[model samples]
Target: MFPLFAARWDRSDLTASLTLFTGLMALAFCLVHLFVGQLRFLDRNPRSRWLSFSGGVAVAYVFLHMLPELGANAGAFHRATGLDEVMAESAVYLLALFGVAAFYGTERALKRSRGQDKDQIEQARPESSVFWLHIAVSSLLMFVIGYLLNHREDTSLIGLALYFFAMILHFVTADFGTRGDHPELYDDRGRWILSAATLAGWLLGTQLSVPEIAIGGLFAFVSGAIVLVVLKEELPEERKSFFLPFAGGTLLYAALVLSEQALSA
Candidate 1:
């Protein structure tokens, strides 16, 4: 009886440790956007190599980890939803495509807003309505990220750490881009709202339980958004981003991920 009780206590302690780690990671996610405005060094004509490096890391995670996970999750999604195998298999990818399209549409609208507003010529901020629309979408993404802090399929510490690093870098790049687009508004209200959305997501995840299929779908959407946002930030001609750092980051992360998989296998 004492041995059984000791085993139960050990399991309880492990659960507590994991819960604390996830909560702290969620807080870090909230803090990244809340204070990302201070990273003014990234705002340069000759673009920051760090941003390119971050983009590379994000791309690596999406392609190597998240996309493969989506494929693996497809079978479970099919089983849960009672849909045809083909439709269920393809559903997550369709959600990912929609995520890309949604962000692209918002990007075009922001550009249009800037172009039409001659009065705000110097600042080049998007109009107020458009700014909120962009913020809403961005915040939704943040919320999903925060929710996944708890719901992520990999409950191990190493898995959570990798997720945290990939996402924190992605957040920095995203915050930089949005802050540039809405210079006045992002710092004033946008970052605060995003930070809150992240916290809100964590709170919801703690309080409410959702189906695994729904969580998988949200994960796929975020994977798509991350890919689009990273490319949009890096691929602009005027940014003059570096290639070496980007390649280095990609190779380094890929090697680490592959090694991790090998060790686990």
Candidate 2:
């Protein structure tokens, strides 16, 4: 699909044009959840299946694209920062590790504060402090995603397209899970606010001129954030999931990513 449009990828104007599309898509992703009840077929029995499938694609993307990119970026980060060779090579992984730990720690703290298993929390539970915490972190992550979509000029158009597709589904799954937990609280205003944050981030990224090292760090952080989010949503023991859909999503996106890498290589 990307190949068919390869020749049309005009570098000078492509990012500018696509930024608008990405922003609109991000906004739409958040808005879609308001109609969740009407979209039962996509959210029905074995509710975690959709999340699992999207999570699988997201995980595959992090492993196949982000990790390698970060590995390469770490060498540059080391050189730029004048660090010891070994330390420089480890920069990306260290940042990613902290990202993972931060997310895990946040979840643990939120759960402990509530004194109840989040996985078992019913819709009737008041939007606890944990709810606002989730909103804040999710907003931050969404903003980073919006920023990345516009700022990653190193990625070819096709690469961004694939990432966009996976992330859109990822957002869908995540938002659905969020709405489930805060049925009455995650209202239209709240949804619009989340969506606005994304657009604001995208607009800001377009105007900013950050360095390569900073961008690399952003990718590492987002990779960790994405991993925790998808896994947490899809892997709880109480949730029913379809393995075939999960595996199929994983393999399908993996194949696409591999093909893209092969062509570039």
Candidate 3:
């Protein structure tokens, strides 16, 4: 939790400013969905092609852009921290894997608890008082995501835009998922906690600057979580995913990412 506040934004750096602006806007867009969840047409279309497209775009970002960037960051981590080269590389990848597993584990636990609560209420058992626990845990995870987005400086406006597009959809699905599990809690307190936590994380991340290695590693961790959460939404057995739209989104955004990298190269 070292402060990264010293690296003040240079007003001349328009690209950074614009990217930062878009990042803020994207967070606002997600926050809006928490209130307007059911009002959207997409909510009715759970299997909407847009979901698959967004999932695909998200998948492409992690695999093509985030992973490669993390590989380089791992190398930097090795140099900056003076870790063993092989071990640093291994650790970096492991962090990504760990992110995926951690998110999956959390989601599973939450879903199970939600189910038990529902069942207990049905049986007329005392209503589960674990609503605050869910709000806390989900808020923490989302806070990390917002913080990591602030750390993603390597991305250009276009890349961030695509990322923003994907995550907006990602949050929408997350809202629906949570609502499905605990309708009352999500309606009353859960969404507010998430919005506050995420916005707070972004504000904190912007104000505090950490070491390069920490930034790189944190970004890698978020990448892993992104992959996990996106795939969970799109690749479940019960959910019907539109394959063509999915692939179309995957290829289109993958090409966009690769092309940008190529141009910058």
Candidate 4:
């Protein structure tokens, strides 16, 4: 199905059918991660690692094997078409927003069945620095995979697969590290806004070919800063457990960004 789409449409010197497919898969992976994370899959440190590994493998397989072949044949099959990058990005953003809304709806339905309290939804259980470390490592992997996919004109299918695999792993790690107490208040509007913003950021990063480090760093900084601010208002007993992942994610994002900047310089 993807190949047929590639054969019919996509024509950038660099954008092959495989590349498009992989890119779409990457977006799908992100959405899945977001959904699962929201559902509290990474509540435990060990489980986070497993999820990260599984996600990474899934992403890597698509990038390494699927992308390269499509890229190599990109020119022979399709002619360059001046499709709007902005429009495409917008579409992805919209998709992400929709996904979040759908997830929230599902969650609400589940809560009704379980008789969960509207104001006291259980937050993500806390984990050790080990979990944070895993997240940091996975983020680094995302940087590498993004870089490789963006820079290479012609990559092997195997290589693309590995890259995507690493990316999913990275997401799992981040998801694990940042598991927080589910908010007591279900703010549908707030969730929708955040989802839209996240999707926009994601689309911009991919469309602009922003360095992976920069993108990751920005995510880390923003998410960490939000967490830290939230902690300031929490009870003393609640502060300790939540801080590590926020700090770790922030540090990792900063490190990756600085490292990349330095190397570029």
Write candidate 3's Cα lDDT for 1-265 as tens digits: 2123122344234345754665675467556547745645556444777667777877877788778887888887798878898888887888788777777776766656545665353223122455465456567767876776666655455556666766676676666655555667777777777888788777776677677777777777777877888888888765688899889988998887776656555
Q: How accurate locally, in lDDT, is each candidate?
A: 0.80, 0.71, 0.68, 0.38
- lDDT computed for candidate 4: 0.38
Give the poorly placed runs of model 2, Cα more than 4 Å off. 1-15, 32-38, 117-127
Tens digits of per-residue lDDT, candidate 4, 1-265, equal 2332123222134455555655664565556444644656556533343443343333333333333333332332222233355543333334334433433343344335434554443333223333333234334334334333443332434334444444454444433333332322113222233334334444443456543333333332222222222222222342223444444443444454344334333
Model 4 Cα shift for residue 199 (angstroms)? 5.0
**Candidate 2 has what TM-score?**
0.85
Q: Model 3 misses residue 99 by how many Å?
A: 1.7
Clashing residue pairs in all predictions, respectively, total: 0, 0, 3, 22
Error of 1 at 8 (Å): 16
The residue pairs found clashing in candidate 1 are: none
**Cα RMSD for candidate 2?**
3.1
Candidate 2, residues 194-252, lDDT tens digits: the string is 77777777778767747778878887888887788778777876667677878888998
The segments of candidate 1 whose C-alpha lies over 4 angstroms from its true place after superposition are: 1-14, 116-123
Cα lDDT of model 1 by residue, 1-265, tens digit: 2332122212223366566777898888778788887887787768888988988888888888898888877887898989888888799899888889889889888878887665564367678899899999999998988887777766655666778888888888888888888767888899899989998898787666688789888988988888889888888775688898788778878887876565555
Q: Which RMSD values do the candidates have, in order?
A: 4.8, 3.1, 6.3, 15.2
Rank by TM-score, highest first: 1, 2, 3, 4
